[model samples]
Target: MSPSQPEVVAARPLTGPRESQDQEGAIPPATTRPEQRAQARDIVRLFQCRLCSFPLRDPVTLPCGRSICKQCLPESHLRLHISYPAVPERLQGFQCPFADCGREHAVGDCGLDVVLSKTTELVKDNLARGKAEAARIKMSTRIAVRDEWEIAGIPSLRSPSPTSEILTGGRLVAAWSMAENGQLDFDAEVVYHGMDGESDDGNFAEFEQEALHQVQEVARTEMDCQICYALFFDPLTTPCGHTFCRSCLHRILDHSLYCPICRRKLAMNPLLNRIACPANERLDLIIETFWKEELHARQGILEAEEIGRHESLDVPLFVCTLSFPMVPTFLHIFEPRYRLMIRRAVEGNRMFGMVLPKRAHFSSDREFHELGTLLRIVNVQYYPDGRSLIETMGVSRFRVVEHGMLDGYTIGKTDRIDDISLEEEEALEAREVTPATSPQSEFTTSEHGSPDLATQTQAPLALENQEDIARIPTKQLLEYALDFVARMRANSVPWLTQRMLELYGECPDDPTIFPWWLASMLPVRELEKYKLLETSSVRERLKICCRWIMEWEQSRW
Candidate 1:
């Protein structure tokens, strides 16, 4: 069958004296027969290690003018030789392993042969890439054959035999050329010939079964995952050259930094550096092209998972500090993982959770607080660098139900929390009131005094309960609250009052919403404000905030 063409790159020449350098074990010119002489330009032979007779790996040169593979030398031979243990050691030397060059040389005097090492590395990398490409081509062909047969209403095909016999000549070669040039050209025409006349139609079922068996054998070798032993979904490759499903790899990495199959050290750093693990792009492309049915099944499962995540309130979470409802939170996002998180947030609901970071000593899953606020993106300003300054406002409170990690950031399923209401009791109490004595008329002018009287209007808003606050006219309550706030040290933080005036404007008209404005403006601890946030009653929130303002007013004396 036609195969993809290999790339051609000009090889760099060795800088040493090429004319003098020969194969390490080459016979002397005086003893060599005329026909046994080496070629004029055989650089590969000249750089071959003297000990292993192969391309050098980490080459080191001996003082005796010979080079060998570092790994090829015995471990014991790497150390300096000491003749007597009692004597103080002043000299360190190495013994050459070559038969004709069994000489002792100073250990520290030897150096790495950089030119030889580089040349060998180039040769080895090319050989490795060639092998990988060949395997990829073979696997791709099997996948293509199976996919086409299934599509054509035939589940039976020989292991690559049907493929080769159908497209054996110029058309197959042209397809290969197109593929090598970065085009997917698998639509080559195939001619069908009727079954041989000698064979009866009765035996077709048995023949078909045999062909199906062969197809399964080839498919099992290529389609099954090395880790899960099932069809691959979201396959990824490790630096150690082993492939596994993305989820399987993530689970394995949670315990260790080694490949599951080879047990090779897959990473030099911690498992948190998962970004270093790269996608197996070639393998992924092959599967997508050839396994449409399997991919559809995988999609079905993923869609179900997405439905479940939504039920659990699973959105991306940002762990940093406390945020409260109706307050603006500014964020400086620069981390690559958070950049991806922000992009997803902006694309989806434009919402994410903001939770405070937990202590380092806690478990990874416990790295954030249970309580968090959901923030809605207001605007984002991008900088020349990839970093961004995002403006957001807190929308609601939520408690995490389940936590999961996506890519490098945190995500969680959460249940939204709302303020507990006094509506049931208030409605029952309102229904019990008599229609004869109206609620407003019962509050005589004597208790509330005249609207213009400073003595009645300037009373502390903190002492008023929900009913008492509601009894006073809105104009009188607003004036009295403003006078009390102006008399206290609450405005000591100038920006607090300035920001409140800028955002909500002077004295909100709605009594129920005024508490939130006052809470946002008060210079209080986040924990205390969070308590106010958790409180369900607007009147209760106002009482708590006013109490704190009065306390601050007393402290000023």
Candidate 2:
């Protein structure tokens, strides 16, 4: 009641502890106090709805025994499309909202928590009573202070809201809410002075601003992509705990299939790799919470870069051999850069260019022949040491228009090549002529149409834009090519022949393309194969292959 003294209210005493014991057959025979049990129950009640952070309502327990608000569960749109049996399978991938308890839960794993529901009702009762008591006390204090301030010529200040007041002090003293003689009291000591300093509202705004600044700083630093040295755009965290922007990780993986920061091998099959590392859902959530603007900006940059990458679509090149259309090529990839190249190729359209080396060089950007074959992957077998043996077949030939290096591998802008065909008149005229004294024409014909014999309707095809072309019968061309392959002395020739026989069945129908298959199976030198590959016309390619086989036959002497 002193004019110069601040108001004080008597403080409430805490509840006395009552000893308790667990059930007789309990596993641990644990001892607890009533106060301690109550405190534990209160702690559980304070846990907010995992999705919305409001007090949990209509509690639903997960398989992990943690409860969340039923309304907080994701919408069951999946049930609309999924079969009843498949519902469990589909929900098996649903992530628990609780941090560090990120265990997946199936729809079958969730049910109403009856015990929690009862506990929630008790908690609601307690909260209601506490709020009502606090409001009554606050109203009484306001009336008493208003009258006292008017009598003492002191200005009356409005009290802060229940939430703010509790956040500042009531919450700190909440443990002292025990009742004595059916009454709760609060005690305080204060120094009062005329209001001449910064208001509490201004101080609160400054504190909020500082907290936001701190959060933004931490988010930017933690979510930065190590490869690009920028905020993560479409961030992906490797199994090794390192995160990077999806595009940056791809660029790094283009050179090495390892974590760019730790250099640890990423656990992935080179033949079945992905665009980036596995996603970190927890980190993604954190980034979205604190750095949404940065994430949006990063997405914009990534979208622009994606458009740029496609503007001039570049095909990765393997400077190894002359792959022809429809011919299977098996590659043993061991080099780090090539392993990355194969990984990316397998992940993407499963296509790449196979070219002969211009010279005996591996790392040089311009070391590959201008003209190459585009190959489509068929299967891949991985080894323990991150190496891979991939099986692919040539799709079409291509001429490298613009070549460059990305990371360490060769990439080229290419134009696909197609075999040239003659005009209808020229084709008919050329078909009338047959070669004399050619090895292909020497096959003896039989009534049963044996593999060695030429068909009666078969004829040579005249290629467009070529002169002085030697003509060979289509059936004879296949016979000669198979014959040339059978004469090869290499150990791999038999297997190659078997594969070829299995695929084309001893001979391919298209005479223009048959020579390339023959060329692929032959034990000819790389240079010879490259020369044969460069030939545009079927007749010219056949003549060159025939002369090479003849020379090889003579050299065998």
Candidate 3:
């Protein structure tokens, strides 16, 4: 070496007892390859709890759209003595711990971020595998170099010649090469010879592909809804840190107000609708980002099911009593089949057809009357024994075109019945009115002078007056029905109680709806009241109501 050049020292490999001492001595600080460390840091940044700075455990997404670990939540923000299956109460203006997100949050508004949670597990597994692989590769390199020297007949304590090359399988395993800086550098490569002649790099690549496939499979399974056992179409997270499909949750709520997984009571809210609950936007975004094709396929399945439901006219039937449009119907559902029907109705559309059961000894293809009303469920309260009290409002009238049995309950295909518009009725009446020159008017005027003739003619004249009464304007008819309802209420009629008023509301001012309201409270045979559903003309319905009221008054007298 020239005096002006820097002296280079050759690195020595440890061996025998010295190597064992090096391994047993003070442990070196844990280290990872640059790329592995970077990957680990990225995962920590993404999924670490903001409060604890550790991998998330039971991740909860707050109302502000940020996620954190549930265990890291401030003690002051949690309700004391909240046991298992019962979610913590609202945080009551709890402030977020994140520096960039100091927004207020309520614990009630938070739910487990199922997709994020699963992703965290995947990332964590990747990190752990990376660390293990790096350590294994490092240890294998040391062992491979020692074995190569031993196979070459080199003593453990002697340094090999700089020019000497150790070979395995005719490939250089350990060697020294000249660097551009006029120094010799030691280079060692470890290769695990396999029966298939595959290089370590190729084996590692295969391992990596298999690991990736496994991770994807796990992710797919994690994204599935527990109830349906399929990929989640519209996922909803409950307050108890459980996730389910929105439709699945609706079905669950219809039968019981508790969560399917944890059995926690689900508080009724506007977000929970008859058909579906509000979807988890965060989890949905995660699913869409990673599994776009699968999610689309799942959504298509749901759409096809919905189409089939509508095309088949698959409506559940409650064969109990007579119901009319714009009227409230209360039901005490106790039978197993009807309870199942209510659950299915609530899960699908919250609607079912209400019909009067066919009279005993009457032979018919259907179990109920053909004319019926469609009732939309407004609220449902479930009991411990699976019984429920459901409040429903009549939506429209329908006539059963076809009917069948389903799960021991009646199902119907029906055509909706709507009343003729007042304009149409008025046009028909105009065309039917008699001209002033008609013989009927002349006969009435000519008989007015004879008392004996008038006496005999009074009955026919009264009938004519009654017919004229039915022809009154809709506004006047509405006024007459309102007056009758008000008078009956003033008299404190048994059926017209305060509770009934609260349920059905005060008599509606609309003429088309007024008749149903009056008839619902009337004490008459349901079969007799079924006439209202059959009538299409509002004027005729009012006439029927007027006659019913007359008979009721006559019976009272």
User: Which candidate leads the pack in TM-score?
Assistant: 3
Models 1 onward score TM values of 0.36, 0.36, 0.40
- Give, for candidate 1, the lowest lDDT window spanning 10 residues: 81-90
- Please give, for residues 423-490, the per-residue lDDT of candidate 2 as tens digits: 21123224533444232234333443232223324334323222322444333434455565655524
Candidates 1 and 2 compared: the better one by lDDT is 2
User: Residue 218 CA error for candidate 1 (Å)?
Assistant: 62
Count of backbone collisions within predicted model 2: 2
TM-score of 1: 0.36
2 against 3, candidate with superior lDDT: 3
Q: Which stretches of candidate 3 lie over 4 Å from their true place?
A: 1-313, 360-364, 429-465
Candidate 3 residue lDDT tens string, 200-226: 634434443444444456556577788
Residue lDDT tens for model 1, 1-557: 12211111012222322232132211122211111111101222333454555455677654334566677654332211111110111123445576665644434334454433553455444434433543443322111212345335463542333332221112122222223333322232221112222223333223323332332334335556776777777665443334567767655653455767768654322122233223443344435544658877976886797687676646799987777666677899999999999988999988899987766684655887788888989899888888999988877677888888899999998866654322221222234333342233222132422221222223333433334543333333444455565654354556346665666456554444565556656666666766665664444455565555555566741
Q: Best-fitting candidate, measured by lDDT?
A: 3
